[model samples]
Target: MTPTPVDIPTLLEISPQGGIEGRSRRYEKFLGDMDGVYRDEHAWQDAVGERGTDDLVYWVDDHRYQEGPGALIVGTSTLLPGRYGEEFAVTRGHLHAVADRAELYYCLSGRGVMLLETLDGQTSAIELTPGQAVDVPGHWIHRSVNVGDEPFVTLFCYAADAGQDYGVIAEAGGMKNLVIADGDGWALAPNPDHTGYRAD
Candidate 1:
């Protein structure tokens, strides 16, 4: 006798701060330990003090798919307004382990920038705002940086098998450039911490 398969439903609702109400995994980055992640170590200590730990920098809510293989993995991230040194608050950034898996990101609210880089050293930046959607191609390492006064919210989706390779970015000393506030606007400047970065 064969067993019957029951259909299960999953619903998710996002709040203003990019929180998805449901079963999810949250990941956070703090300012205290981000000195090595940003370009300016001096500015980081000045902005958040040397031992600041209570400040919430950014977080991601990963809604893992439980339907088995080939299911879509969805997630949302909220980058709070602040600075890591002279750089804005940002995701640690990562590349897909498969190197051929793609991802899509939709901006829910606030403003930010999406940074993309290839393993061969190619780099680009996309300005993000409310209602904007960006497709991240395969083999590209990506990160999100918040440049607004308010929280930056983004919803993203990708394949379940698209595992992340975060250590590559960390070993490379983060992205080639950093998004920073310039007066009332934002600017992209070279990251001092980025080693072996080539403009070409």
Candidate 2:
């Protein structure tokens, strides 16, 4: 006989400033943890030397009601604004371990871009401001780039079982495209260091 699901429906209070009122867990990424995440190594080193290792770069507040495959995981991502050479502040991107799992990122505040690419060489960059959102399809690796001067905050949701594969970008020498600062906006430039994404 099948067992009844134990999780009860609950409310999640998400703040436009970045966090869940009753988050189950919170994780932070520091400047030191972004060793090779940026394309400009020397610039990254300079920033690290100036800010030190403990400088907080980004953080996530997530609420997971259950671990089942059918469960949903909701979270808020807050990426502090910064510049490393020409590239803007970004999150260490990932493709869902399940590969076919999709996600939604809704901009709550500030300005940003959702950089997405497929293993087959397709790429897209969608800029978002307050009240904007992006529906990320499966098979695409995605990352967030903050283009504004304030904290870029977003409310994200995806399958609870869609574990992240953070190594995909590193393995590919970074995503095929880089979101760089334009005169007063942002632009997508080809990542010269990227070789290509390997098939899973």
Q: Give the TM-score of candidate 1.
A: 0.86
True-vs-predicted CA distance for residue 109, candidate 2, Å = 0.3
What lDDT score goes with residue 104 in model 1? 96
Across 59-120, the per-residue lDDT of candidate 2 in tens digits comes to: 99999888977889999999999999999999999999999999999999999999999999
State the lDDT at 26 in candidate 2: 99
lDDT of 1 by residue, 148-167 (tens): 88999999999988898877
Error of 1 at 36 (Å): 1.1
- Which pairs, if any, clash in model 1? none
Itemize residue pairs with steric clashes in candidate 2: none
- Which RMSD values do the candidates have, in order? 3.3, 1.9
Candidate 2's TM-score reads 0.96
Off by over 4 Å in 2: 1-6
